[model samples]
Target: MKNFKEKFKLKLAENNYKFTRQREIIVETILENENWHFNAEDLFAAVKEKDSEIGMATIYRTLELLEKLDLIHILDFNDDSRVYELYLKDHHHHHLICKGCGKLVEFSDQGIDYFEKELEDKYDFSIDEHKLRFYGYCGDCRDK
Candidate 1:
């Protein structure tokens, strides 16, 4: 995770931004929790546990900077909130959300390459990335 922190610091430097203490704490917290999908409020709460002085405004600004730098991806599950995750190229997956219970299951990119290739051939367009989400009831929710 040290390398990732260094990369974030370098990105900030490249964009003429200082890697402030608050930003460092925020980034370190994010890196520590690799599988977290959280919004600004969630992040602020976690960060507050580490440092009480950090505020919501700092969280929002740091999130904006991270998104601008393409270090994180925002998942808008259409629930009136934005969730964030690290942008790891090799760690590609999609979401399966249970509407009834609000549960999230992650599925791997097993068959998407073929579909992307087909789309590229049909439309003569190059595909860069995509986000797929499936929403329905999980087994427990469905049985209920």
Candidate 2:
């Protein structure tokens, strides 16, 4: 928690932005709950518990700023809402989404990486980044 707070402070300072109490609460919430894939409304509710004066607009704007700074990732799964996760530096992976229960699983496979590299080489193009989401029924949903 301390490390996250320090990093947040540094990031704010580097960007010449002031570290407000609301921003601190938001950052702390995101850092502490690493597994939660939250939407802006959900995050607003969570942060409101810490500081009731924080508005939803503030949360949305803060999330956009954080995304711009590469501090978090914004995921769009063809759903009505967008989800966010903390950008775990140096940890690259894709998501396996359960369409039935809306559960998301993270996975990294060397075979996928090799395939991507080979495709890029064959096409004579440089692959910078990609987002792969496999949607299927989870085990529990399938059993049911």
Please give, for residues 1-144, the per-residue lDDT of candidate 1 as tens digits.
787789899999999999999999999999877466777887888999999999999999999999999899888888877888888787788899989877778889767978889999999999898888999999999999
Off by over 4 Å in 2: 1-5
TM-score of each prediction: 0.90, 0.87
Error of 2 at 41 (Å): 2.5
TM-score of 2: 0.87
Residue 13 C-alpha lDDT in model 2: 93
Model 2, 1-144: lDDT tens digits are 576578778888999989988888899887767675788887888888889999988998899888887778889899888989877666778999998888889889989999999999999999888888899999999999
lDDT of 1 at 18: 98
Model 1: runs farther than 4 Å from truth? Answer: none
Q: Please give the distance, in angstroms, between residue 143's alpha carbon in candidate 1 and its true position after superposition.
A: 3.9
